[model samples]
Target: MPILPPQQRTDPHPDRTGVRQAEAALVEHYPRLVRLAYVVLPPSLGRHRRVLAAHAVVQRALPAAGSRVRVPRVPAQSRRSGAPQGAEPAPEGAGAEQGPSGAAYGWMRLRVLRAALAHERRPRWWPGRLPAPAALRPAVPVVWGLRLFPRAGGVDELALDRALSTVDGAVRAAFALQLLEGLDASGARELLAGAAVADPGDAVRRAARLGRPDRAGARAMLWSGEFDPCTVQTRPSDLLRRRHRVRAVAAAAALCVVAGGLAFAVDAGTRPADDGRGPAGVAAPALDPARLLRTSPDRWADTSRVDFTAWPARGGRTDDNALLGRALRAWAEPPESVRVSTTPGTAAVPPAEPPQLLFADEVDGAAVVLFHDHADRVVRYAEPLSGSGGAALDFARTDDADVTTGAAVVVSRTADAARFLLAPWIAESTTRDLLAPDTPGRPLEVDPDGVTAAVPRPGAGGACDAWPVIQLRSSERIVEKHAFLLTDLGEPAPTHLTYMPKPGRGTPARQPREATGPDALLAWARTACSLRALAGSGVRSVNNWAFAEQKLPEGGASADWVCTRADTWRGPGRVLVQFLAPAASPAAPAAVVADREDTALCSKFGQHVLAATHWRAGSGRWYVLGAGSRAVTGIRATGAVRGAAGGPTLAVRAPRDADVELTGSLSEGGTLTAVH
Candidate 1:
């Protein structure tokens, strides 16, 4: 492909593209556009914030309903050379010729650049009512309790990033267009002008002075996870400050309410604190054990719903008022002595109405009470049988649960074991080691209350010797008869595990079979231990999909690329892409190429995934190997040992730690960059 002259004539009023067309373009080229915005945004905002702000800009770039967006068309010369007349200009950086996604990609890129550049400006009162700067305003998709920053690179990326930060946003934008968008010097200037830059020529000149890196070095610095905002690592966000702020606001609110009422004192001679209410107080649910909502033991048999709503209240301690009252009071307002904890994304507030009593039992010599709130939260209150002051309250989010996932809850967890309270539909419980697929499942002793005896927990003491999963059998007619798998992830509720057949296996997306059989057990063994990363992240279910397999170069056996996605009860989810080598140890960690949140890649909805890793051949030579899902029609590598193939696999001989960029061409005429 020849490089044509830069497109001139920054069309002030470009041709309009339909909303649907722009949306298609946005979805197809999402990562590229986001990278564009991330590079253009000012570094002062910080990497994590810049990443979130970049995503926000791209997501909000879609044209409004019933409105068409102005998108620039390819220059006349390019159209005459090859691209069709009236077609939208292809993104110079995206490596695609004119296509349906080209026009929309251009429009979205323009919008992202404008928003990112404008974000650097500050609102001024004297500037004829200038709009508030985007930097001063908050960006959407905020994450609490986690600091998300992009993956860091070596000294080269750090130096370049620091250098770029020193320049103005316009110059940074011009530089990024050339490096990331694959734009020529003149093309960068022209695009910057189209984005409404005041001095495009000056910006381009300043950018040029930085000295462009070689093709391999530029791709290594730009295309690597270094500047990709979508992929990030999470750290705890100021734990002490967050706690202090929460306590301060709560204390202030309480003080204001009490002070106001006392100061006014006009309410019918100041009514008593209790009025006519019981000792539990008006702020909490009725304290009496009889007031607790309980369903019949057989309610699950006839109900149309198979969720937690159908779980019957069980255990011999249901009539114990003293224990029940303590549980109820602790839930409403836990004392400082009572340790309270909530999974990520779970609200820490009390229930608005009376909660459904799922279990009030004595398990492992402790009085445990489980309540299901209408807000999709499951709360567990536990107190020692010795009447000691030690009590614990735990909250977990469990929204949108069905029989397969909501069938069991961890009632008690000891040092080396955990006990589960199975649902009414569960007939038998057993445990199996995923690593040893040939071994039979061991039976678990379940008491009459549906609470199982202590089963050995896997991943104890941070060692992945064995990965244990509970195999549940359902006896009820309403519930599915197939057995399912559940694993404890250090939470009150166990995360459900499902398996997706490899692509082209004639398996439907929605019907992910239970993680059973030798094949699934083997596949899961490679990734089950990885669940430790999601222990307290409020994950609801994890689905494992063998997305791709490629024959290794140099007479090595084939390798598999498995994607394990943990979908949280909260909307956001996390994905892990692993490269599993043949005959590797079950306890050996998979080579993770991509691990990030809020992405649809390798998911049931988005079946496409691209990843690369350096592997040594049997002959001891180094090679850069890449693989993609079945939908990928071809794979290509550039910079430092070029390679191209007609299928989903690519292998090129290179240095041991070469800086290579991998991109995949999809059957639908779209392209995808390697997972960051």
Candidate 2:
């Protein structure tokens, strides 16, 4: 038989009543606090870690033995004994004089939430150093504890868990608080905002959709088992020893490096020249055919290679033609100086073998050639032409070597006989749509070899109206092509185009669908309403009082609602819908609207309103009433408003004392009417 240790005795400390009260609160609320912790702690932390974190939170918040307990604030009872005007009466069972316990409970809950959020943000270093209490379980399994009813048929627990896992931590927390704790979106946002959650409203909305569970079941399954009171069993002495060991090691390492020298040394002799050319006598590597074709002219040159040809001509009009001329000149020059070899006494050196031709084609009167030299460089040369040119002035090259084997060419046979060759890698099977609607020339043929041209006969518009024939000379043959007529070609060409590599075969992920137009927005509102109903949330009209009061843009569409029953777990829900017509669709009206609703049984007090109206065309005017004496400034209409025969005017009126402000474009030129 083992000898028993002396019995432990409580200290005879002051504030015994406070200690007992704190103990009583802890005993009653510990389980709920643990549940909150399970939801708030990062899901990445295992069940044991979550339980440990929850216990730590409670230990930090609850009053310690022999500690002073502060009294909680309680609302004063009415002196007259009857309910005051516009004030709600206390419940029948409620005491006339209540202790601070209610307020203390709220504070404790908040403290637990705050502590959980802190743990989520900065997890403990040694989460599993101490064993977790067996009674605690992860909140996920008991998430149903917050639900009013069991999951509906076809609701998979595993799937729900996966969906929750996909949501961001902050969003999950906000969603859990709203769904499990009955917090409104605004309240959740406030709590999370203090913890530095970005876009709390957005997070809440995302969570609401992702966390929705089927609602076809009856009573929820209650968690059984007695929960043990949270107790702190952290070994501070062991932690202190570890900290001391780490500090000693760090100090020793610091001492060892105190007199160390810098590891790197500068060597000017080893540095490359400012021009980036290799050292003297080092021959540049032979250009690989693939590499040369993919390299851009600018990358090959150290300095700007803009001064090779005189085709642009000084004082020439600064237009696409001039730019194309400059580009052609740059392509003709090489970055490295060409090495010449000859007998010491010979005065003449044979011209280097004509560049090995890779491909050739003719556009208008210009001859385009793609060729490479032994120096491992490729050049695109456009032969000088006499006629006016009509080709678009854009150029593109492929940076990828793997796909640079092919070439593309665009040809026009219309009055504007234009032709151009694309870089090899950019070129593929010829039949690509190279001309935009506004492009000067009409496409005749596109092929990998190069574009052929169709010559134009003389027409009324002088030589400019007539398409010319372009002659191209290849090693084996001379090719002739007709060119497009060159006229009205002074406008700047569109920027170059790039083709991204195709993605590998796989099912693409689905993105959340958003409503873009008025019709779509209304439809979205209906769908959201349906979803709310399915989750047992009552349906309300999309155009309710909150919506009718705001000055939405003319022809614009918007949808807003609150989703309380968004998930199986009962919670307050809120949604905001705002839409604007595409900026490119000027004729379309731009509209915005903001609406708020609480789906919970107990309604929350507050309203959010946002609205904007499309501007009217012409010199029209409008006025806003019911929004105090604020002036309605008019905005200029952009793009045509579709179907507004004479540019319709607008008028709006609201209560003179309503708390509303107009933003964005306002309608103009309409009768001032009161909004009744």
Candidate 3:
């Protein structure tokens, strides 16, 4: 063999660590190694399979005795004081790796990384031969019948997961090194290079572009169970199939098997039912259709509670056992083909118990069922009547729902229209175009099933030319009947619209009124486009208030100062203060003065709001104008310009682009800050 190139030194030496050393390292760092593999594994395998595969990769990474590979020292501090389980290990300064334990840890880490990267590689195909079995098939480290997954995380976790899914495996490895191993860019790059990444530098650069959070944030998210495979929630997979398997075993044993097999059959049969409860010793949470919580039809009339708890289960298909069973099964373990959607920050998980049935009816051409978890979420499941495999599920947060916010729900939606299911107490329903303020509302037809006729959707054509809003009037007598408007923001539940009129002096701000009539509709038409930002954002209601009206200095049209606030179900509300010039076109966007969050201004609890902007008048003169709510007794401007007003509004003649700090003296004797 011609010399063999002088015993090539480029190749790595065989691992020489003893089995006891490797075992010791693995025992101490099992969770950390599994987390690294979990983050590197492709998410396309789904959470359950990825979890099992991650554990397998780490276990297989243990090298046989008598192997040698030079690696970074594991650091004395790590052995002396290791990170807790489900936590990222801290990086340490370079030093001598004193023991076989340190080398074993590094060796195991590299093996896990290589195995993960190899798991993602595409197998080479040979002509006329079947493809080789996947290196790490999902079934390899299988636990029969159980689906395991990490605990759910908030929107940030969801966002990071989604962002990682879009990139390649090498970049994921780089990120895992940084996120799970506390490695710097250089350190990660070195590991990737050792793992044979095509371009380690490129992978590290791409990983940095993932909008990775700072060190603290990354550690906090990594600490969550979403990234840890060791700790997981377990649920039975394919309940229907499991039930059939149990029955088949029982039958086979009844025929040809002996007493031992018969005993096995009995144990299997008595394990757990589809409803998660067994025959005699059952104690699991109920998931059966018969166990669904229902309320009386007239419960809303007798109960003072105006939320979804008072809503009765009324629909044509409520008694359809086949449909109800399918709905329940889908909720438990939805098929991969089922279209699942959820609002921001909503956890996508199976119900812990049978949810309260809200509605189950046929609308348009599909069968729809709605459920309330009796907690934070309202879920909707729909399937086509003509069964073309078109099934959809949607989830929206409704923990903050009240009478007005819970009045109606979008039962069905078409390509360009939506049908609402009105509440039992709703006596009348109609549609009005916010753009056409003077036009009378058209009556909306409701079927016997309480599903309204299809109404044209706003911004359907990708333009804000027409904004259709639904007006619902309660049945509690004319004088006491309250009418509110609801607009669909791409969710099953529409957002409640309200209005607060300008407050009078010496009077606290009044409770918000139902957003109806010409004035309210006109104010909304100019600001409806802004609602797009809150679409699918778990908004419960939105309120628009006329805080102040100010006269312009050079005989210009009076401008209306309105504050629009959108309250969400899970987080702080959005606030926008706009200055609308009268001469602006109907579709013209308002001149925004301030946009903020979590402010008490324009809300019933807090009445004071102030904003200022530099504007050019009709006469071409520039002035700094400040407007505040009625509670403001005086307004003053400082910084780039100085001016003062005794009342709640101020117009100071100043140059263009002048910056000013605004402060207001409240009637209640405290200083009020501007919204900005």
Candidate 4:
């Protein structure tokens, strides 16, 4: 019933060959597209904002443009190529990027990217393949992306996302060049030109004009593309290429990234401060925690409180110590979230107004508050737990920040006397034989409080146990001849307790067994009062790397318990636990090796230890885990020297001045070549 309008006649479909389409699209939007392409690098850069404008513009235009394009055909092949069949067209013959000449640049990029992505060659071609990420034709983004779409021999999610989103050749090329190549505008242009794309865009053109390397800017460009899956390591193929490519890019892209670094590109990933040697020479290799306030002003993400533009400018580089000191002072001041009130009182210029508060965290997302002391000594302030015992705790600095910021902790308590466990000393300790030939000179010292001082004692020579000796404190004074860690079941208390002191956990690498003490606690050299052999034997060492009990003290009963295994190291000898029974009789002591399986189970046995004992070498006595012979008097004889497997290695003490070595493939028995 409807009358048809004059028969619509469609002009014979005009050839939209890939090349024609690429060229035509370039003609229309080369400038716009090139600008868009250049911004794949992130805006996080410090200095240059080359493509930010382009990123915004391209994002807008991409959705509206008729971007679909077909392959361009060669004149000779056009006749035999079935009009639209057999041979896929080449992506060739376009100019490289130039702001003024971007059309030519965009066109050229179109060709190369098409060829690269398609696994096809341009005219004047003999068939050959490209860098295929896969064994098959073209390359897949992932083994899975291709398998999911089996029809497409070459498959990639980034490619699929790009193709599905943008049909424009110039847009497609831009995405590939900026993100895939990790290039800044100028850098991208140079590479694109080599691949035959013309005048990229104004952003790139400006970077090229600079001539000198802008490494910072280039890195910024690369990161700007970070949100796009293609740029970041999204797949296994990218991971495999990372190591080799890291070296290659480090060599190839150092200069361009100079600009990115300056533009704050590195801030996104924490680059170092500059020294002004040169761009490369200026930037530091670490992100100072003090400077963290400059970048992340608010931990809770309140934009209203922090203006990104002026946040870093708020406080011109506060000293790390000053920050920590102030934070500590602030922590000590209030009961909850603190608020400062100022009146018009003239009090000597109002205490020199405090720096803008970047963040006033109470305990800083960590159990302990970490900061640098005025002397540059790294300090901690820990949150206190409800006290059941240990009377009081101590707060102390472990090491200087310039040297180590290892496992951070908080200073919860301040005691007259303090205990410490040094990592490096423990790492290097060669604690093997504690059973001396004769009743060793003196008994290991322990204090009423749990602190076992490992610091170098007055006038000492060799390291005790090749480490520091454990000391206990009675109130503020060092308690002599008392080792609190070891709790002897007999009337005379045992001195040495668990070897290595650490948080308690379940037995690892072992079958569940019965434990006799309060909840299994961290393995300290000091044994529990219930154990008989440990009575009066100074608390010695805990097998930190063993699969024994973990809980520290738990009212005499807790979780799964197990014996330890022997663990030996090549250079450091071995670490293990020993059980000394009713010290009057030295025959029944047992031992357990700490590094039985190199910590096959990490949760339970993940603690370090500090211990000391005496070893006689010639006339000189060496106190294990201490500094010199003076501490040798602290050693008490134990009857047994057991290996890691919960058994005795020797029933009686070995002769003094004898170099004893455990039997192992790595042990050949060496002398104590002491090097002070």
Candidate 5:
């Protein structure tokens, strides 16, 4: 390219060819721009900060890179900063050459760059005005350190990748392009083929391609999961795992996204449509389960997002997985826009369907229906719940204390003149049950709240039934069964428990202190169920659950626990048993036991169930109703919600206690063979 003198040039915007000086400027300042970016970062951040700041500035500069504007001509005889055009008249009086993303920084640009860098914590410049060149002159040493030895001021590939893990796809792409591939915005997009991004290029095709059946990659990209921004890691499962909304896009658009490689996705949603009717492809936006919940308007909004799908049963009660539901209700948001299919007579409430049977409490007149399921016992989770595939079972309140004694999830369907309450129960009858060879840790006694806490084996209590004792620390003197559970993940060892004591031990106390601190909570549950000693043996798949509620007794209240335990197999199975000390006061640890049984009842398997109800003051619903593996066990109430039209909707949610397994041969008459 031939160089032109300041006065000899016709237009200042072209490269050496006089085509348009805009692009030439970008290329000329490319290295300087990257360096300038590093300069504008906080010095305290030292090196890594330089990389991050550089990344952001360049990305912001990308969209503005192709712009063109008028420039004042500088005398060719002068330095790169050029002599002030105002001081020396143009030979032809033509304007000075211009550049892409041109700021008023020629030689003074260095000072302005340095100033911007120094003031990085707050870098804002007026339109067109650039920072003082003198400012950057002072940063020359830092600049030298960065370039010559390059002491970590430039983009460290590893660090950049790590940082992008938490950032959004667009920002991530932008960083990847400029930092990784060293491509400009135009170059990057050309590389990414309009990725399912906000600024995707060549819109219409990209939009259409998003939902296209054959494009697996596009689908994956569309369902981007929420990532903690500070972390910068990409979550591949975000998209697919979300409540999926269906929409489609074309292959051409998808191709663009794949090619653009970066910022092109930013312009994605803005493309023109084929029908020239609607917008480009409709973007299937992913909802942030965390943030949305945090930003909910109602004070009592749900505070978390629970993938209850994980611990379906008791592996179950430790945490409240209903936070997301609470948040949705807090924000007056529905889990699913519509839960019911339009039948012949029902009116359609587009985009808002209450599950045919859900617990909706009206807030300021708006319906806040959040449904949560509490099982009587923990068992193999072979199915999903609360959504489409889930059946809604609404229960009317009754004042019962025993979970096994009351009705469980009885749904009533009304016909022309009759209504029937459906249940999984047969006539109540007591019969000989079975169990498996015993191991360690007395089967948990359901706690006061229908749960049991497994305090430390006590180094004291002796090694847990040999499987492997997982130890945990706690603040109480007792142990419960439900406080711990056995799973096949990781090292199959007995993980210990941590329990806090009930309040009011010293002064005349009010209500029992919350059974928090993992151990104490476990103990509270353990106190309910009784635990019988198990002989030598490792038990197979088994589950348990309990429900707890206060019973009006002498001076205060009483506690009860119902346990439902069962194995997840079909052949010959063993049984494990445990319970709390009935004679123990409101504040003692429960006991446990395991046994082997014959002729399996429902598929040779071991299982347990526990439930309870708060005996209504007048209706008199007493007895902790519960059942286990076709065997109805005793029970108690967990919690309650206000019911509809009738009375309070009592939640006879089951157990909070731990689990136990037995290891021994079936032919053995359940001998208490000490493993040691």
Candidate 6:
């Protein structure tokens, strides 16, 4: 190996010319940058700290060839007045066009201000304190030297400074950017995003309040050293930490005491081990059935009219051994003073009849009955069929009954037969529509003016259950329309029925629609997708694509898809779909992408139905796809919906492919048919 003579190593130190150029530029821009930093930072930090922080920020923002850098020209009108005109426009390709020394004066100013803002991460609850004018005199000589206010009819400089100090730190930063730096709303918002501000305009507005009619003048007054600095010697950070620690300790101590008490109570109340012989043959303590049912307030006294409906049990007969039977037996014979109807075969009443009592058998081996009176009182009774004749009962006056006409009635029930009654007189009426019909053998009825109609429903064991459409009418007109659905119709029929009101159908527009089947879901998805698109397109768009991707299914064709939209940024925005792929044939890349695009589009535009209207699952892997986008046009799926042997393929139909075969599976027979 021939060893070449050692080449002399070049010195890594910067050339003398570069050092002088940098020094010259720093000398030119240092004052302006310091002023910018001083105005923005003094309100939050100590005078000494603010000046030091400003120097650091300016040094970092300074160009290497500082002396050669050209100061961006501010329009004459903007500099002379505060009419939003003086700031220099950012140069195109700032870094490239400006070169190492090409950064615009406005750019440097903003950088320094932002750096100062970030220097202190003030806690939300931190009470800001400004430094005394005397302390700031050494660092902000220009501001201190200026005569802020005239002697006659001018704003009080001291009052203005105190007001500025009282404003939030973030708000003060926004004000400084807008009034002092002349940045517009969009620019301020962009800069404030890192400072945890949701609305820069709001922040500006809050800060502007302190300045009033002449914001610029008021700001000038504060900068002119008119106010006395706070005399408190406490540092904001230290005080905040101490306060937080004290609160935390107090909370912990209280929680420990509560936990200890709860533990002692639980230990003392532990029941003796139950043997097979049932409660040691002890007589059970009696409970007031009325109290058990009083889950909500009562308003039944205002009720003037009541209606009733009854349906046969889905399995054909009521449970003879239900706990409800025990309740019924306990209260079957009312007190002598109370009125009782003992007619055996009269349980069936005409639709036009105003029967005070309604009876039905639930699929869950329980019998349920509801009773209402003119006084707006209601009693709900339910019993399990497995036990011999005892029922759980609840009764209360309707707290939300109509006080005037007493014709309006509201009944809210849970899956467990817990009932809340409301009278129309006291309750607000909002119209809603039923999305589906009632279950087979589970007839639902609605009566207006003593006229009723039996709601027809599909038979039991169907793929889906039936829901009822109810129209609540008053003398004026239909007060509210709603569709009610029971999740569990088995014994005691779910006390809770979901009330879904139709959109744009005599209801408040801001109210959210229920997330039900494909159609409602598709609508919701469209809203979410639109919001995502808007946010993504906005200046502060956040790219949450990774989060969305994580929610997608790994390996299957989906049975259903959901697109959820959140109004706030913190909420989730994504399209989730599940597909089944047979264990034999894995889903192709195109198929997976198609499903994701479908969901994403659904989320964006609220339209889920694509060329492929329906999908089915086989014995394959299932995959969930979560696609996130802030833009409405974030993900576009183009292709004909086609069904293959393994699964469905939704091809992206772009311009290049003019003629494409579109196929779909018949939900009935799983037969493949050409759609387009």
Q: Which candidate is the best by lDDT?
A: 1
Which 10-residue span in candidate 2 carries the lowest summed lDDT?
Answer: 490-499
Ranking by TM-score: 1, 3, 2, 6, 4, 5
Model 2 alpha-carbon miss at residue 305, Å: 71
User: Per-residue lDDT of 1-676 in model 6, one digit per residue for the tens?
Assistant: 9999999975353333433433454576575456556556644343434454555556665444423433443343332211112232232222222122233444554445555665455442232222222222233323321112212122255334334544555676776666655556565565566344667668766665446545557556534532212111221222322444476569668867876777677877665342212122321211112211110112232222122111111112223334333433334433333223221111211111111433333423555545442223344455555766555544433312222212322232343232212232222222122222111223223332121232232223332222332222233232343222222121111111111122232333222233333444222222222221222211111111111112112333332222222211111223322222222322111122232321112221222222322222233432112222111112223244222322223323223323344433332222322211
Candidate 2 lDDT over 343-362, as tens digits, reads 11111211122223334444
Q: What are the runs in model 4 whose C-alpha is more than 4 Å off?
A: 1-290, 294-676
Q: What is the lDDT of residue 624 in candidate 3?
A: 91
Task: Give the C-alpha miss distance for residue 135 in model 2, angstroms.
Answer: 20
Candidate 1 lDDT tens digits, 1-676: 9999998865343443345556776887888888888888866555666788788878766656544334444343332112222333323332323222244466567667877787767442212111244334445667888868788676457546755665788998887777677667776776687678999999999877553324346555878888988888876643544565576579668867876777587676665453323333433334445556676788787765577877988888888888888887787778889999999877767654567789998788788999887667889999888866689999987765677778999899887899999998888789988777778999988888899988778774557778788999887586556789999888888989988767764453334678887768878877877888888787888988887888898785888888888877654568998888876575466777788786545543356788888988778999898988877889899987788998888888999978999999987677989986
- For candidate 2, what is the TM-score? 0.25
| Model 1 spans > 4 angstroms off | 1-270, 276-286, 387-389, 505-511, 584-588
Q: What is the lDDT of residue 373 in candidate 3?
A: 72
- Reference-based TM-score, model 4: 0.21
Q: Give residue 65's error in model 6 in angstroms.
A: 40
Cα deviation in Å at residue 520, candidate 6?
Answer: 9.1
Every model's Cα RMSD, please? Answer: 15.7, 24.1, 13.9, 24.3, 27.2, 24.6
TM-scores for every candidate against the unseen true structure: 0.61, 0.25, 0.59, 0.21, 0.21, 0.23
Which parts of model 2 are misplaced by more than 4 Å? 1-22, 66-101, 123-155, 193-205, 213-676
Number of clashes in every candidate structure?
Answer: 1, 28, 6, 123, 170, 81
lDDT of each residue in 496-596, candidate 5, tens digit only: 11222322223431221222234333443443222222111122223333322233332234433323233211112333333332443333444333334
Tell me the deviation in Å of residue 321 in model 2.
77
